[model samples]
Target: MSADKTILIAGTYDTKDDELSYLADCIRGQGGGVLTMDVSVLGDPKAPTDVSKHDVAQVGGSSIEAAIDSGDENVAMQIMAKGAAAMAAQLHSEGKIDGAIVLGGTMGTDLALDLCSALPLGVPKFVVSTVSFSAMLPPERLAADIQMILWAGGLYGLNSVCKSSLSQAAGAVLGAARAVEPPKRDRPLIGMTSFGKTILHYMVKLKPALEQRGYEVAVFHATGMGGRAFESLAEQGAFACVMDFATQEVGNHMMGSGISAGADRMTNAGLKGIPQMVAPACYDLVDLIGWQPLPDRLQGREAHAHNRLLTSVLLSTEERREVARLMADKLSTATGPTTFLLPNQGGNEWDRPGAPLHDAEGLAAFCSEMRAACPANVTLEDLDCHINDDAFSEQVLAIFDQWVAEGIVPEGVS
Candidate 1:
């Protein structure tokens, strides 16, 4: 509702000129500023946009002439998407736009994803699409905090139903821009990862300890989306250090499961030269949707159904060993100091003795493979305890303290 907040309304202005203009009017009616970016490649809007198609193509290192010459809709749109994304990022960097609302069907949605991803985590991004929440959009393709609304009955022309979706999306993006509070860098921040307390309780102890030392702690759940967000921030060099304990996503990806954080999950912090203390919590389990048929390889394997929406399957010893090798290979490329914490007893609650998903041989195979494959650059701490044990948390703090003392990790503010 604030007049000072500006929202970037982006779409194919040539085809959906009426729709995009209505969205802009809705924002203006609420006393919010608007910036329009036209991603239409073939035709022009009746009037000019805040950013034109020629400008977008030029920014993407091509020209409108070149795009038209290509004669392929997909290729031309891709060119526009790249330019539009770069322009959005530029606008935000230059303090011109506070948030963005992109409108489209399938093609527009594809471009919208890239545009929103170009912005940082906290800036509001709303996508009003016909394919809202459709399976065609993969988890890895979404911006972590992207908001979407179904453009019900609003595909071709403006009607009451479509207008409702647009009006709400316009207000939502503006309101979010006005109300959002992005994390401040007042203190050094630590990015840690874990599951819930039932399986990994180390965060309950580690978070407060890290904060007491004058650092902020952010513990990310290692679910598919959560890991995507964690990796996105890490790619931006957002953390002073990282405690990456729950790496189930890596195993999920290696096992070809649908419940995966993208292939580059465990590599971001290292690529950015952020000091990381890593562990394999939940490394023995590959989570699958509870309602779906189990994968053939996991047909008779031990499993624990977390709920109607989620299930976890224990990996065989050979699979565990293979995953260990995968983890080591990913960690081997870190440019900064790295430590690997290997717990001998168990990785998670379900892997403890007599637990439903417990597998001693698999755990042993994982540990043995990790001990052998861990690169020379990574310090391997083979601890005689479960990942959930008090000693594991203590070892983490001790190593962090040592890093601070050795100047590998900077001291936190008082």
Candidate 2:
């Protein structure tokens, strides 16, 4: 590990020269190197940068000439954003920079998002923005696994309030780059989805069983953003295989809930043909708007408040079948090997003969629809045990083991 780190300071130097310069000095005081990349769209930067706006805008596949001549701030920013991302990526590839930190209001954050995304995962990326925690921006727009800091009073210039936030961000990025080890993945990475342990506890046992067989298990929550990130990384071939057990987001989206990973959630892993095992875990619970009264359509449905922000509504027999159909249509197009598993007794922990969520009719509905829509390349498996049962995990592992032996599963670095 190197004692010193190189930090990329990416921001609009035309208007934020003082704040950016202060941040660079703070990083240097802590024994780190700085490479400032200017992303200004309107005027030339007040100070010199290692990489100018012209250098970055050209990289974005658009010319700064078009931006200045058009007199459209949007057009210029778009071009500069691309250029900044291109320049930063090139520097990182050449070992000129290790991590990045950016300070911006809104447009700055927008450009910063692309720059951070261009740098691969495991590199510490941080952004200081006024809207760091705003809910108006969908989590899907948060393109990278980038950390965000609330930029208090960092609007136009450097002040006491602004300096305090900028200084901390500078120190934080430097310390992280020096101390944080790259996220290591030496085993076959498995991407699994889950909700709560109570709803899907098989993961607790299944994780170790897979690790024991020399594979890494990476679990993604079934929340909207979690599903999106999983699919994005899947498209990038990040996982050797995936255990898509929790299908709650699928049900949530079909019902037009805000908790959707878009209509294209499960398509990536299928399109990429990564070996996958699919299950209807938590499919009985549809995410509904929370922190307020339920909609009129859900007037008589059984609902459970997952938290202050989100609630879960029990689906009817027909709705369960609809979800199954949606999933089948999506999974049927998979170019890679796939196994769709069904638990005849229950799909989740509390869904059984006498439990609160048990519905034999609902389970049957899904099974029937999936069977009818399953493609020739996909296999459907039915187990007599509950989803959380030891037998269920054993069956899933047995299939995975067979896939590995047959070279259906690959070893991946991500």
Candidate 3:
């Protein structure tokens, strides 16, 4: 394949030959190069392709016949994703690709997304699948510059809507390829997290403050995916330091709030030994979908809806202690200089005086437990102010500056 503007079209050429050919032609007609790879395990493809089913099986460490013979669709799909990712990684390493596209049903979409995930972010990745809307493959794993989820039926016999969707998707892919450019660095990379309630606060205050500090702030919404993305970037050494303000997701996971970041969220920076400043920014409550949607055990407990989108379930004394323990466990793993700032008055706006989820006793329990459990290497400080207080913000920034200074020249800057 030509390295310049080449698009890798990966899928089962036997089943998707017509659609694949149509896509390939469309890409070529747009003055772009195209390479097709067959990922089908069962049949020989009719189209002339750069990579065949045999090639994937060989790279994937399994035979196509063996996959087909297994009769297990899930296993087969996993093999395809693994093989396709391996192949794509190899091609990427060779610098022979600029973009990629794939078409399939549920299985095909899964396979393509896996391969796409293997590719670096910002690359053109597209998937035209029959089950795009119904299928729930993780979009985070895909490798394309843009993902266009088209609603269509089986790959065979296209309807008017399907044809229109495919055409639009093709245009999007080509447009992405032509328009894609490297990100410009004019701002410092500041890592920030927020939920729907505090989003306005972040957009107004913390973001502007960081930008004023001559840093480009990368904000991660405190959803599960946002936290994962931030952690992923940290693992890649992408941030100078992280200001993990909205750590409420930790509570989510702790309380089974549908939005947990799992165990890996806070561990990345600590393991990477990056300078970090953390806070119980919104620790007063674990987020749920709605007040009535809470678990039966949690029913009648103090709950408040921050907005229509988020319901906050107040943490009990027991839950607070558990969250504190988990926080301490995560903090103990830090390899670099770190600080945990506790806002004595409240963690979030919702936990302040006159707020619905406020619980001074529970908050105190959490802080005390964390202080007792935290390793000596990780500094713990309690501030007599709310999280949004300017004093708190200044303290965090000062501590961050000190950590950065220590990291830059460990012995003494003087």
Candidate 4:
């Protein structure tokens, strides 16, 4: 009745020895194997660990003496974090561990992030942190599938309340490890980006078409976190081709909005030499957190309160031009084949003729800038229709088909 999977338990053993041990015991009780990693800098644990602090320091390319002599807590912990991350990643790669669970407060959570991120996207990584889901954790630092549980009342000493959280976290990681089905690569994978149907409907038609053509399609939402995941996969060279149409996260990052994928968004696919079909879908908007005060530069713009949590601001004509230039600049650096798809009338549903966010003049400005700023290496196709129209999808299919015929894109699964 026991699970055969092994879970790596990581924490500062000198400080949280009892708590970390409890997590290990819970996993073992469920028939799961345990491997413990101690990332402490100053003190020794009551019991020796599977991976000791000195071992972590050495893996991080420094010695325990060097870390202690740094005379700074942050510096010492960073050394430990680097070592712990590498060790965990190495263990998983060698098939010695199936999943990992890390326990900590702020300092422990910081180290936990690096350790979890070191593992690829789908090897279960869980964190028990005092600052779970807090603003202190930036969106860019999060791994796409990382899980977190709040350490609640058990910060100092383990109690019944804290035990509830720990016991659940232990069981959850073990369960996830046993249940996860790694992605199958039976067909060539195509990565596409877009909003939901209300804003962008191309994916509704595109996904099935791609699948019918013997390819696998993944549609990523163009919100902050979603874009981050898309970019991370692109960097890994995981896609056969990328249909990157929903690109608002680029402008969001350029405008210093909190809802940003990252500064490196849009450039990864190109850097990896992955073929990309780029478009400026939703390029006329900047997303901001509704709960926070609006930035001064965006205070007076046309705004749509999507929900209590999010607000979308319509960019000025001049702002739209700036974003177009930024897109062009990013495409200019592509070492791979790149194509720019320009829909002359509008980019999204809200920017159609009579919609609240529509502005013909703004759309025209964006189009002109895109035409003028597009790089010489990129093939630009100007479509005389809105992005949401049937004609737009047809044009996309035409380009995709041509690429497949020319051997630029991979052949569909036979």
Alpha carbon lDDT of each predicted model: 0.92, 0.83, 0.74, 0.91
lDDT string for model 3 (1-414, tens) is 432478888988877787777777777777788778888877767856898777887789987777887899788777777888899878877977777788888788888777877777677788788766442544235332337567465467656766677677777777787788854544446677766545225335666666665667778887666786787677666676778878888888777666655567788887988778888877767888763477998889887776776777788888888888888888888898788888887777777777777787888888888878878878888898888777787887677567656654122112
**Residue-level lDDT tens digits of model 2 in 238-261:** 889989998788888889888877
Off by over 4 Å in 3: 1-4, 61-72, 130-150, 155-157, 185-188, 196-214, 290-292, 408-414
List clash counts for every candidate, in order.
0, 2, 8, 0
Cα TM-score per model: 0.97, 0.91, 0.84, 0.95
Candidate 1, residues 135-169: lDDT per residue as tens digits? 67876777878999999998798999999999999
Better of 1 and 2 by TM-score: 1
Worst 10 residues of 4 by lDDT: 135-144
Q: Measured by TM-score, how close is model 1 to the native structure?
A: 0.97
Question: What local lDDT does model 4 show for residue 279?
Answer: 90
For model 4, what is the C-alpha lDDT against the true structure? 0.91
Where model 1 places Cα greater than 4 Å from the true spot, the runs are none
The true-versus-predicted C-alpha distance at residue 198 of model 3, in Å, is 4.8
Error of 2 at 315 (Å): 2.5
TM match of model 3 to true structure: 0.84
Task: Score candidate 3 by lDDT.
Answer: 0.74
Worst 10 residues of 2 by lDDT: 135-144
Ordered from best to worst TM-score, the candidate numbers read: 1, 4, 2, 3
Candidate 2 deviant stretches above 4 angstroms: 1-3, 288-292, 411-414
